[model samples]
Target: MIRWDWIGRNLPEIRELLGDHIVMALLPILLGLLIALPLGLASVRWRRLYQPTVGIMNVVYSLPSLAVFIVLIPITGLAEQATVIVPLTFYALAVLIPSVVDGIASVPTHVRQSAVAMGFGPMRRLLQVDLPIAVPVVLAGVRVATVSSISLVSVGALVGRGGLGYLFIDGWQRQFPTPIVVGIVLILLLALAADGLLVVAQRLLTPWARARSSA
Candidate 1:
């Protein structure tokens, strides 16, 4: 209601900022998925490292996002501050790693034994047998991480990284309603859109599970 012209007219800028924030949020989550999947598979293999590694990621994930941004500045510096992507990546481990482990572990022992009996090697068993079965659950974790990162990355703008948070800061200092409203709305929409996409992806990834779930 407060002179809506700024936001109404400047939608393109809002869209760009939202897009960049979403992309930045996603990069870390994707990287986390890459790093987490191997370690999770390894956890099921080595057994000894599972507790320690998962615990560490859990701790990292628990830390405040603001704290992470501040902590990163000392090492990475402001010019390249957007690199808070690393902690965001690390923050995903608690949910993703555990989900990957649980998903693999959930597969009934008989299926694995049957695969091995049919001459599949350990690697093949994982890829063709275990992982396929695990996909449905691992994906759930990825979805959670993806959504959380989307919301959290707005804080990245605090470090001059240029996210929707920039709008938030500008809105506050200038006492303008447009930047604040647009930033909040954009971030919310981005989170919802990402969550919806992950759900669609999960359906695509596990047709059999969907069928079974429906039945």
Candidate 2:
């Protein structure tokens, strides 16, 4: 039994929590992209680095998120968003790096030969040819990472940085269900909205991939 009046009274606080949640969730994805691009490119370019790079990221990903938050609290403090953002960024890297390596690998060999024959330099070829071709695969990874990040941000509530996650804690402590239900609903909506936007982005960015698949 939800209390509608309670919800109405708490709208402002909920909005603030949602805003914080969006910031906490999104900043990691953006940061992970910036870091993963170079690491992924290096892994692909060097070949030998891919196994080890991914191995370390996998280990990092496997560590419990709650434990990581506790470990960081001493350094970043209990209330700092960095305690949450730093670990989540690493998690995003774990997923994105593989996607990037695989995406670049999916590029056909003849395409590389064609780029070389056209006298395109390494940088130009990467920007104009390789990355464009890899967008579909990379975006697929982004979609997964984005959803995972949104879901994981709730864990930060345990440390005081979780956005709507605070609602879960509040609801539990007070023996009330409304805040918990509201939190779940809002998180679900955010995840769906984010995923939908990424799908639209994939279509706009890689129209040819859709055409090829349909054919």
Candidate with best TM-score:
2
Off by over 4 Å in 2: 213-215
Can you give the TM-score per candidate against the true fold? Answer: 0.92, 0.97
TM value for model 2: 0.97
Q: What Cα-based lDDT does every candidate model obtain?
A: 0.83, 0.96
lDDT per residue, candidate 1, 1-215, as tens digits? 45688878977887777778877889888888898889998999999999999778877877898887788788888625356687788887777899999999989999989998999999899888998899878988988888888878778777887578788888889988878877888778888888898889878877887798789
For residue 72, what is the lDDT in candidate 2?
96
Instruction: Report how far residue 171 has shifted in candidate 2, in Å.
Output: 0.3
In terms of lDDT, the best-performing candidate is: 2
lDDT of 2 by residue, 66-153 (tens): 9999999999999688999999999999999999999999999999989999999999999999999999899999999999999999
TM-score of 1: 0.92
